[model samples]
Target chain A: MKFTILGTGSATPITERRPSAALLDLGNESILLDCGEGTQFQMLKYKVRFSRIKYILITHLHGDHFFGLIALLNTLNNTGRTEPLVLIGPHGLQDIIGVQLRYSLSFLNYTIDYRTTNPGAFEEVFSNEKISISTIPLKHRIPCTGYLISEKPALRKILAERLPPDFPLPYFKMLKEGLDVEHEGKIYANAEYTLAPASPKKVAYCSDTIFDLGIASYVYQADLLYHESTFTKELSARAQMTFHSTAEQAASIAKAAQVKQLIIGHFSSRYKDTSAFLTEAREIFQNTYLSEEGKTFRV
Target chain B: MKFTILGTGSATPITERRPSAALLDLGNESILLDCGEGTQFQMLKYKVRFSRIKYILITHLHGDHFFGLIALLNTLNNTGRTEPLVLIGPHGLQDIIGVQLRYSLSFLNYTIDYRTTNPGAFEEVFSNEKISISTIPLKHRIPCTGYLISEKPALRKILAERLPPDFPLPYFKMLKEGLDVEHEGKIYANAEYTLAPASPKKVAYCSDTIFDLGIASYVYQADLLYHESTFTKELSARAQMTFHSTAEQAASIAKAAQVKQLIIGHFSSRYKDTSAFLTEAREIFQNTYLSEEGKTFRV
Candidate 1:
């Protein structure tokens, strides 16, 4: 799994940092997370294959998170995209898009499978053969939710070296299923012909949320965890009042979750240099990385 | 008056060309004409002093023409802009932005004085000391209105060298008004001290419109006329079907209106090279110029 950061700025717009947006590419398809204004332009600048995006997941109804949706969707329509797009967001997102499109005098050729996830729940919201998605309830001024995208476990691999040179292809499925296969009156043991698959990967994304230690279990042991660090610890009071998290608080959440790696972004516009956030976050979470625009992180 | 081209593409978003947007600066304040998506980024890219923008005029309800407005206004608010803004557009534009802002949970620090225009009639919508703005009715798929920003006539120039060194200041206003003054029982001819002011300059902007000859009178003798050339003459049929104007048609309108200079833009995304548009437009009007991004035209 590969994660690309499109925008790193918070609600405010700055030239150095864009608003919140990211792309998660998982081989089969990609997912767009929290499209802010200028997301399309950033996607073009970063040379992302935006056409491969099959699902779009939005966290909340904030302008920074949802303003770019109409533009992207309309551009997609104008560009003649026929593949169905699945859009999952808060409850009122569909109606808002409907109104904007109505005013735009538009009719899309591709069908939009609009779905809404309860920001107050932590249940699985989407599932496919390659991955499963669940919501992480977040504490924000508005109804906000993070996403936990977990790659589905692959089938057991066949130890081809152990198999005979002329092994029948029909028995490969049984061996991959970790079962013994008796083909042509000969027994093939599961352990001798098969090996266990690697562990599945999980990426958790959180933005525009206040410091909440109680929800650490929602992102426990994720392969990669991206949390908002809107301010430094010195401005912890301001962060709390604005329903945002400081770098130290995000690092604390990462440490409590015990994730493999932590990426912090959604920086406030007041900060010109982000080195302080990195230094402070790394003090608590040793495996912390700063999310920069156009940078890609691998899991 | 100085005009800066912000975006030049049609509805479709492309790398080489952006959507429709422009800035008209009249020294004291500026006016934004038809803000499209990524307009704020273009403003930043072109180094526009956005704080001085006092009036925002939108042509229609198309997403490309209106999506970036919310982001711009929000950025202004975040940057502590307390000066009120005047927004003039179609009838439903205010409610559309209102719905978007309501969903975004936004409360602006400054007030927005909203006004609507009739796309079927020509009338003045805004007037200030610097300029007067009128709506130019255009034929389009949607109810769209172009803008005619006319610079206010300057005060008559005083030949200060012809006056006495100790001339009283009380008569300056009268001299500027071009009235013969009697100072200390001495006759001072208005013609001897004052010269006629330069004629007022006017700029006409039309986008997403068809080739309508009836509207030529509205932009008659404009200093600069910017009209959309969405297609070449070869695709005049397609342009007619889409309710857009071709380069030749725009040139025809410019020639018919007797405008001083014509600027054509809003090229269709199908063509990457825009020299063809310039070549065809110049065939009919020799004084035509291509509206390129970041380029400024002064009148």
Candidate 2:
């Protein structure tokens, strides 16, 4: 599993550092987290295919976090998208989108399965064959929730090298089922013809939240953790005043949670140079990484 | 008198070609025409300062034409702008922004002087010392209107070389009033010390309109004409069906209006390469140019 950072800037309109957004690619499908303004451009720059997206999870109603959603939906309609997509967000999001559609005179060509998130608790929000998503209540000025996407373990992979060049396609499923196949007077043993499935990975996406040790428990032992670090250590007071976290605070959460890797983003527009954030974050967590637009991290 | 092309693509979202938007720079103040999705990024990329923008003129209710407006206003408020902004658009724009503000729980620090455009008329909408804006009725799927901006005649320029080393600042206005400056018993004749004001330039912006010769009368002899060219000659039928103009049709309007220069934009997304549009338009109007992002044209 892999997740790509689409935008890193916080609630401000900075040209280079865009607002909050990220894409979680699960090979066959993708999920969008906190689609901020101009996120489509970031997706385009990253060569993201529109058809691959299956779900969109919005953390809150902040304009920087979800303002681009209506237009994005309209564009999807214009581009002739017919697949039904799922949308999960806080309360009032549906009303906001409904009002925008009425004023803009827009029509949707497909269905939007709406799911509202309960920002007060940490619980399972959605689940499918590919992945299961849970909400992580975040401490912020507004009611907000982060998402934890846990990939489902896959079936065993067929070893292409052990199979004959003309091996029948029907036996691949049998191999995945831990069954041996005999074809054309030859027997292929499942033990030697298949590999075990890779361990399922978990990716946690936290957007716009204050520093709280409670966040560590929600994202505990995640393969990859993306947390908001709106300020540097020098601006910790400002961060707390705005109900946002500093880079050091986010790194501390990663260290406490013991996640495999941590990516910090959602920087405030006050600082043009984000190198200081990385420097401060790395001081607390050794495996800390700064989130950059269009960069993907494997989980 | 300069205008920059911020976006050129029509309703559909394309990675390389953005939607329709333009910036008119009038030295001290700027006016934005048809702000599409991601127009702010275009403004940021082109270095269009927000404080200098005094007015925004939207042509229609299409999402691609004005979806970015509310978010832009929010950003302006976040950046601590207290200056009042003028927004002139369709009937439901104020209500749209109001609903968005109410749902997002956002408060504006600055006032927005809202004005609804009359799509069926050709009359002066706004006037100031620098420019006068008038409406041009356009034929489109929805209620659409174009803008004709006429620059006001400027005061006569003072010839710095003809003045004494310590020429007083108070006499500059007298020189513009065609009077001789009596400084230190020296007579500096206004006729010899001043240059006549350059003729006022006019720019006509026609967005999302079908081919119609009636437009020629409204934009007659404009210094620069920006007309929609959503299709090439090969797609003339599609253009007519969609109420869009072909490149040749835009060039025809330029030729009929006797404009000094023509910049055609709002190109259909189907055509990956726009060279054919330039070739088609240039065939009718030799001075025709393609609207490229960030390129400024002097009127």
Candidate 3:
């Protein structure tokens, strides 16, 4: 899976920075997270295929988190999109989208299924054959939840050289299932022909949250982790006052979780230069990266 | 007064292009016309001072025309803008803005005074000391109105050499107003001391309208004119079906109005290049230019 950061700016407005938005590409399917204002342009800038965005997860109702939704939906409708979209957010999201559509006389051609997030507890919100996703309860000014996506374990790979050249496809399935295959009256041992599957990859996205130890357990041992670092250590007091995390705080969470790599963003607009953010994060988590717009990272 | 074309793409979403939005800088005021999805980013790209945008005139309720208003308002509020903004558009515009603001839980620090547009006859909508604006009714798929802005006549230039070195600043205003200055019983005639004022400049913005002769009279002899050319002459039939205008049609209107210069944009995304649009427009209107993004045209 690959993750793309569309924007990384926080509450304050600056000419050089755009609001928050991110894209997660999982082969054929794409997911959008926290579409802030001007996200459509960010999508264009990043060459994201809007038509392939089957799932959209909104962290909260704040304008900086979900304001781009209506415009994106309108564009999808106008462009003749027919795919069904799954929207996961707080309870009032549907009402917000519905009222705007009503006033604009917009009747979308696609189906939008809204799934309400549970504010009180962490819960599994979405699951498919290839992936399972759960919510990580996050502390914020409003009801919010971060997402944890775990890719389903891959099937064991076949030792093709050890198998008969003309092995039937049906027998190969039995071998992958760790069973002895009897094909054409020939017994084939499963262990001799199959190798163990690779480990499942885990990606966790945590943003718009204060520094809390409770989140470390949910995002533990993640292959890749994205955490919001809205301020530097110098502004830790301001970060607490605003219910946001500093670079040091986010890096500490990643270190506690033992994440392989951490991507930090959602920077406050006060600092025109962001080198200080990376320097501060690296002190706590060595495998840390600063999120840049349109840059993609593999998990 | 100056106008900048921020975006010109049409209904369908294009990866490299953006939807319709323009910035009209009228001396002390910044007026936006037809703000689509990513107008805020476009404003940033064009270095427009968001705080100075006091007025917004929307041609219609189409998604590509006004979808960005809510986000723009949210950003302005978050940026701590307290200036009252005037929005002139269709009847339902206020509700569209109100619902989004309500759902997002954003109470803007600034006040937005919404005004409704009436089709068919020219009506004066905005008037200040420096400029007066009137709406010119036009034909479109929806209730659309063009805008005609006439800047106040320029003040006479005072000759510094003709005035005493120690002359008070208050008399400069009188000199600019064409008044004779009597200092210590010496009468200074206004005509002998000051040069004649420059001619008043007029700009007519005709957007999302079909080819109609009625608009020519309202925009007669304008210093500059901006007309939407969504198609070329070859696709005139398609333009009519979409209630849009061809480059030739836009030029015809500009030629009929005897406008000094013509700017044509709102090109359909089907054409990868815009040279054809300018070429077609120039055939009919000698002083026609294509409206390019971030490029400013003086009137």
iRMSD, per candidate, in listed order = 1.5, 1.6, 2.3
Tell me the TM-score that candidate 3 gets on chain A alone: 0.95
- Which of the two, 1 or 3, has more TM-score? 1
Candidate 1, residue A158: lDDT: 95
Reference interface contacts recovered per candidate:
0.60, 0.61, 0.55
**Candidate 1 — which pairs collide?**
none
Candidate 2 segments whose C-alpha is farther than 4 A from its true place? A152-199, B153-196
Query: Who wins the TM-score comparison?
Result: 1
- What is candidate 3's TM-score against the reference? 0.87
For candidate 2, write residues B175-288 as lDDT tens digits: 987788899988888899999988899999999898999999999999999999999988899999999999999999999999999999998889888999999999999999
Writing each residue's lDDT as its tens digit, candidate 1 over A116-202 gives: 989899988899888999989998988999999999888899989888888989789888877899977889989887889988999
Error of 2 at A15 (Å): 2.9
- Candidate 2 CAPRI assessment class: acceptable
**Comparing 1 and 3 on lDDT, the stronger one:** 1
- Which residue pairs in candidate 3 have backbone atoms (N, alpha carbon, C) closer than 3 angstroms, thus clashing? none
List the candidate numbers ranked by lDDT, top first.
Answer: 1, 2, 3
Q: What's the DockQ of model 2?
A: 0.44
